[model samples]
Target: MSEWTVHGSRTIYTSPWVELDLVDVEPPGHPRYEHHLVKWAPVAATVLLNDRDEVLLMWRHRFATQTWNWEIPSGIVEAGEDLTVAAAREVLEETGYQIDPRRLVPLAYNQPIGGMSNAEHHVFLGRDAVHVTEPVDAHEADRIEWIPLDRIHEMIDRREIVAGVAVTGLLQLLARRCAY
Candidate 1:
């Protein structure tokens, strides 16, 4: 397989969170094709731990998938916002934890769906997260809890921690633990 060249692109739809584009592309040895591309704003997700060493997580039921799972606090990084700031803001808004932006350490990055979407996820680790208030976002989560580290694998095996970014963040933390 060879790289596809985009001759041109036009926005098909635009929203606050996403933009869809129709791109004219030419693949090697093939005629021109119009491909539908979805552009998602960059995302920032955080693995937050309290002083007690328990990881903070949101438990929610996703209507899209009809499943309840544990997830990290995450949100889109607004244009021109620093990734660390976005991570801290998300955690604060979604989980009511005010994490110091300076303490938010980059952990990993990934493209959940690389084929037709341009959504890059930035994951961070926030240690000693402090609770400042109740969740400010009305629709943030069904519940928030601090789960012990040893129970993380149990939750994963039970399919209770299902969000891709959340899973990736925890895996990175677990890997780093092994390294030390």
Candidate 2:
């Protein structure tokens, strides 16, 4: 077993989305060290598909990266809530599409290892959805549009949507399709 010691920790920043912390610790057989850690809230996302095989996507401006990117409807999972429930809620809040929990197909989970913290993302595929209203999360996304499934590869190759979660979810969906 590895030895661990936490000397101290401090919050570097805090937002509704995430909190960053700097922690001083000692690792096994190593000198004392400090690492800037991100304490992120759990997030849930959905790959919603319609009868026409179109994927629901949102165009948003990521202020941290200063880039406009295409992403699926997603949000921070509330504490004590089931991941699937969170996914359904996020889709409805972000894209105005309410989907049954049973319709959600588990796709993948992502923990961006390159990042300082472990932010687990639960991704699901929402099959056969019907639009009910317009997006309401003004701060989260600018526009919600349905992109044809067949064109996703071209968009990815062109670097139109570069979010890791979106890419992973799309690839998982593709793999599932190819397996049939």
Candidate 3:
């Protein structure tokens, strides 16, 4: 068995969303190596489907890439809160659509290979969604629309919705439907 020892570690940066730590480690019979690790909060997202089988999506401009993309409502899981509750809250806050918490389903957990952050995304099929208010986080999204399930593949292929969580949630939904 190979053994590894952590030589040292230092904080590179800290932010509300994430913290970066740089560490030096040595593997058995190998030279020292450096690794940059990111610690992030757990995040949750939802796929809100209405009675018509349309999925609610938000059109937002991601400043990191300076491009607009379609995405589902998602947010960080607050301390001492349940992931299902957070998923329901995100859908309501981001899309102004309220859904029954009982309908929230376990979709999938994802970890972006580029980062160490792992976010558990819960997707749900909302069969009775009603628009009751405007989006709470106006700065996060410019517009919101309901897209048919059939067009999701085309949107993904066209480079419209590139968010990892959104893609995984939608694909899980499709897979579940196919299994039925």
Candidate 4:
């Protein structure tokens, strides 16, 4: 398939977390038209696994979805922030787990809503994590727990772990584990 030509884009809304834009575009074999584009700042997330075959996760309710689910430590990366550093920082801010940024390895990257949005997710795997303090973003989650990694598949099947980035990271880790 050929790429659609973007003639111009105009911002309809702007916020620190997200933006709405209207773009004039022309498809390869179609007429030109204005399309809605949803945009978000780059997001970074980390799946923190320990030697005990457990993964750090947060139980939280997403207001937009109005559903409770388990999620890995994740947040929007600040403007000009390094993705790896943002991943580590999110872990500490959300779960109070301090992870060495240098120890974080890229695990997965996805534009989950590519059809109408430019939301980028960068997932990292951090195996070396230490609890340093209570969660700084306490309101972000109802509970923070170390969940058995083996139960992840079941949790996901039960709709407990449903965040796209979290699912992507955890599944990628599981896939990697089985590969080795």
- Highest lDDT model number: 4
Pairs in steric clash, model 1: none
* Model 3 misplaced stretches (Cα beyond 4 Å): 1-8, 27-29, 114-126
Give per-residue lDDT, candidate 1, residue 49. Answer: 72
Model 2 alpha-carbon miss at residue 20, Å: 2.4
Q: Candidate 4: which stretches are off by over 4 Å?
A: 178-180
Cα shift from native, residue 179, model 3 (Å):
4.7
Q: Write the per-residue lDDT of candidate 1 for residues 1-180, one digit (tens) a residue.
A: 979888999998999999999999999998998999999999999998766668999999899999999999999999999999999999999988898999878888999999899989999988877778988995879989999988998899999999999999898888797542
Clashing pairs in 4: none
Instruction: List clashing residue pairs in candidate 2.
Output: none
lDDT digits (tens) for residues 1-180 of candidate 4: 999999999999998778899999999999999999999999999989898989999999999999999999999999988899999999999888899988888899999999999999999989879899999899999999999989999999999999999999999999998542
Residue 78, candidate 2: alpha-carbon lDDT: 86
Question: In model 2, where do residues sit more than 4 Å from their true spots?
Answer: 1-8, 178-180
Task: Put down candidate 3 lDDT per residue, 1-180, tens digits, no spaces.
Answer: 676788898888998777788879787888898877777677878887765778889999999998889998888888887888888888888878887777776777777554443334455445577788987877778889989988998998998999988898887887786542
- List the global CA lDDT of all models: 0.90, 0.83, 0.79, 0.92
Task: Estimate the TM-score of every prediction.
Answer: 0.94, 0.86, 0.87, 0.96
Candidate 2 C-alpha lDDT tens digits along 118-161:
68878998886766887566577888899998988888898778
**Positional deviation of 148 in candidate 3, in angstroms?**
0.6
